[model samples]
Target: MVVGATRQSRFLFYVWQILLTAALQGPIKPDPGSQLGGDPWPEWSRSAESLASSEIEQECRQSVDSFLRRAESSLQSPLGSRHPNPRDMLFFLHVPRTAGRTFFACFLKQATPPSKRCAKSYDILRLNVSVEGCGLLSSHDDYSVTAVLPPTATVITQIRDPVDRVLSAYEFAVEVASRHLQVPLGVRTPRPPGKPRVDTRNVWPWSLLVPWMEADMRMRAAKLRSTRDGALKENNTSRREFVRLRGHAGGWAYYHSLASGASKEELSQGDVLLPNLDPYNNPLAMPLREFIEHPIVASTIHNGAALQVLGLTNYSHHRDAAKLRGCVAEVPSVREAMVRVAVQRLQGMYHVGVTDRLQESITSAAGSLGINLTGPAWRGKADAAFEYGDESVAEAEAPTRSDGPYSQLIHLQNQTDAILKELSRKQKELEQLRQSSYNSGSANAVSACFSLRALPASA
Candidate 1:
């Protein structure tokens, strides 16, 4: 995809060169033998990456803008009598906190037969794109991974309202943490050991995240209940109280309560038992506000939709990668550029769906891909479907207060909200087109090109 070539800014031209020479040619796909588990959490760092020089950053931004424009323009061409083919590939870009799991189970699995669906890549980046005849791949992987796919591959994704997504992510994180931190389901054998060992094998991708959230919530809770003299109130704290806080209160208590009767040696290894604990300060409880403002959480939930689409998110493929709290969107120019590019990509993708419009999206996507849905589609509620170890958590609910503490950070959602509006508009236009075709008794399949007008570069 190439943007206009006439009287282009020097910054835009430099970006175009990079995109044409590198992105267009695509990166070489590595051998499938190097597959490994996906790294959701890297080492934590207090400092963020320093911004590149103004000129350099500007050039990169312009390059992204130019490429997106070209991509949108390329998709504006009319559709043909093409039908679903066995050889065609489908990539479900499963954005987090969206009803992606539900979509996969209800729509994707139903549309693409088992023979053609690839093994789920939600926890691994190494895909067997070479020999596997699978037609579908879904994961929480960022846009950078798309470079591995062939140009003809169909890329589809579902997005949610930014505020709702952030809230859902928090609720899910707390829910997962409570399960992992709670008592083991089966009877436990007494350890014959010098040190208590934590299980680090076959762990979930959210393992690191669980500990981090626990520590943060504990810290927040402690602070809230602290004395005026800056001391935590720990008077007669019993094991039952600890259990209640850890289990029912969503894991918002200190790691080892005095009443639990943990030994000195066991207490010494508390860091191992619960990673990311601040040894200097006792932990506190967290409500939704603190969760939103926590540096790690802020980096993730703040403008996450745009960042994930632009492939600038901190979820690296390598465990050793330097972690960054990506606050680059704080810069006005960068934010605009990112949103513009993301909106363009969303408009141009093989299929774009919104969480609120699940049934309609499924119907539209099924029509575009020339596949029939197995049954009536339905929207999956986050609270109802969120599960732990095959058992449903009994009382999970996302925060509902619109005037909550997270309202202050609502500005961060501006870009994503804009993208949502654009997507809604596209969906509406597509529906109208479909209805007009039906009224005329045309047998043509409504094309996947939802938006014919590309957003201007200046937009």
Candidate 2:
């Protein structure tokens, strides 16, 4: 009996040795290039590129369980029995020029715990972003990004006054253009007695200049559209020529045409900023009056109704909120029902904050979305860190921007005074349109070519 027991023990030992050998030969070593900047205790990677779906789900479960433990621990004080809704995921739709970067920093600080990770990037939406991994995700995108989210995901967004927003966008583009050149054109002002401050850098498109003299721009755009419509579907020499001609509508031409005079071949690399034209100023420049009637102006007024960019003919122009007016009214070619549906979808968003009222907006969002953040920091005034135009030392030093210079010339304060004056006039014009007593019952306001006839109060 003793001999038999010894033989059995020997067999078990042999089996254990084989198992140990196999494990040593092929041990579990983490990928050398693994994205691993999350909770050290948690077995999750930010990218999750090397993990299987099952592994991802496991990691998610672990993370969620840990989250729940932390949440439940907060409630154990015997103060209240009411359970807070621990929302699975939250999304921030980062619109351009909306103080989004400043707000984003606050959001990240408020979101992830001291140890937990927060995943941020436009690319995060490319993956199947789930609530299981982490609670936060943000991007510079529209409603289309919803496809990748789980049902528990809540959306947050901020909207800016379209006129100010556009101006901000334009100036940012100019800065990018200056940076793109070998020797940047931006003027650096001397810092005051205080230490130089660092500011959040934003990702913005460098050369999306909306044309001046709306009439000329529209005429060119229309002519180009007509030519394209009549052309063949296949690529040919005519197509190539047409494409080259289209390049003339880019930023370099816009800047040079206004600055001095640009030729067809004078486009800068990335076609961002062009070489300054000779004479530095032109007598035959297009006036603000001519630009007031541009199609983009009309498109801006009517674009508010579109919830989905796919519905609008020009995705860029139609991004503005037309206060829920229908695109069909402006672009009669589109279907009324479709436009209505788009409007309805936008109206259905969880939260949309006006940029001017950011503090109230975000606080309200936290309550409605069940995020537990509550502090004076989250509820800042207009001059708080969440506000735009407060980050730069130059901006602090520069006096109230007047339409004194055309585009803001950092050097010569009153340089390009012609366009600066035009911009001032344009601001008032856009404001008038924004506050217009237009026909609200009709859905067409989203993208319609609206006239400036002031409707009587009775109407």
Candidate 3:
């Protein structure tokens, strides 16, 4: 069996290589969207040999935000801008599938019987959102909502392994498509006793319904995916570029699943929640490269160096401690600027967590935010494992795996590798920082150490 599997893998790899080569032979088409083009060419590649330190610093600061800083610095200075106000509204920009719904369930204690949480779509709010009341607004957005948040409100979010995030999103797409079409997919485990459950809303996803969607939508989407796939073969793009360009290969599976609704026997054996509605669905929600985009914040600050986009702006790599380090081989400066922005913004956050280290991330963030999140609700059935979409959708999902090779089990290798690599890097960084802080007699040394012993056996 092992030999057979290896042979099959090798065969697939060769077949993919051949397909890619053949696709690359096509003549180039004059496509518009020069700036946002799928081309892998960087803006700086043409003229500059290498960016100077001063130039990089100036450009980084000017382009996005200042350098990264630890959260402890803000905790020490009471007069510093990051101090939390008791009455402050906490704006949780709940990026789908980042263990955000889980965070809301475990840590939050609404002043009222039910939390006065309101969720919104980015399209409705555009780049800015502000409400009169002191409440929580979780939205699918990047760094833009920072402008509208109350000065006292703290921003909190979680990130997943890039590969995991993408894979999970893929599963979620399958789940959602399955649900809409009344197809039985995964199995659902009963919620554990004492777990908190929050209602999640899925706003207008018109494409979910074929009747409402365009008649030729699937055809157009297929052509786009083919064109992009072919283009990718010739372009030799980066992972990020490939993600951006893969315009929805699995969309056809989604439509097939929809067509197969509620009939397991009719279901395509090879479908993977693949959709033919690629161009119509929101790109950000796709398990693609830009899934970690800085929330579209409302703050006047150009760099997004605020508490809202903390995950993006507070880290020198534009990734919070939770974000998986990308293979940023191309356009290093662009990534650097993003990291600066993340770091700068993170300084403003009360808590930031990652899906891989969800237990620690949740606990650590809760401590900073001054929330006590201990109970069966936290350790309960609700925290089954990391997955995506809104809490309600998660609730509705039955956690059964799709049958066969294309199941999530196969995808875990990439996600696991990414997670393991990040965990190792974080461990080294933490150890070094600990030693440096120990010698320097810094208070941050105490706070920086993440306590992982609190996690469950599976975690």
Among all candidates shown, the one with the greatest TM-score: 1
Is candidate 1 or 2 superior in TM-score? 1
lDDT of each: 0.48, 0.37, 0.37
| Model 1, runs deviating above 4 Å | 1-84, 184-208, 217-285, 316-327, 374-459
Please report how far candidate 2 places residue 448 from its true position, in Å.
84
Q: What tens digits encode model 3's per-residue C-alpha lDDT throughout 1-459?
A: 022443333333322222223222323332212211111112333323376655544534432322233333333431114545444456666555567656665455332113234333321322122322334545444443342344455676666655554434434433343232221112233444564433221221111211111112222333445666576576543122211112133222112121112223233443344322232133212222332231211111122222225433211112221121111123466466456655655554566678889889866866776555543332323221222332322212111111223233334443554466567779999999999878777555544544445556698
Model 1 Cα lDDT, one tens digit per residue, 215-250: 444333333333311332353333322211122323
Write down the TM-score of every candidate.
0.51, 0.36, 0.38
| Residue 52 displacement (Å), model 3 | 19
The predictions' CA RMSDs to the true structure, in order, are 23.0, 32.2, 22.7
- Model 3: residues >4 Å from true position, as ranges? 1-86, 109-123, 126-133, 181-331, 374-459
> Can you list the residue pairs that collide in candidate 1?
218-283, 218-284, 219-283, 219-284, 220-284, 220-285, 221-284, 221-285, 222-284, 222-285
Worst 10 residues of 2 by lDDT: 393-402
Backbone clash pairs in model 2 (N, Cα, C under 3 Å; residues 3+ apart or in different chains), count: 16
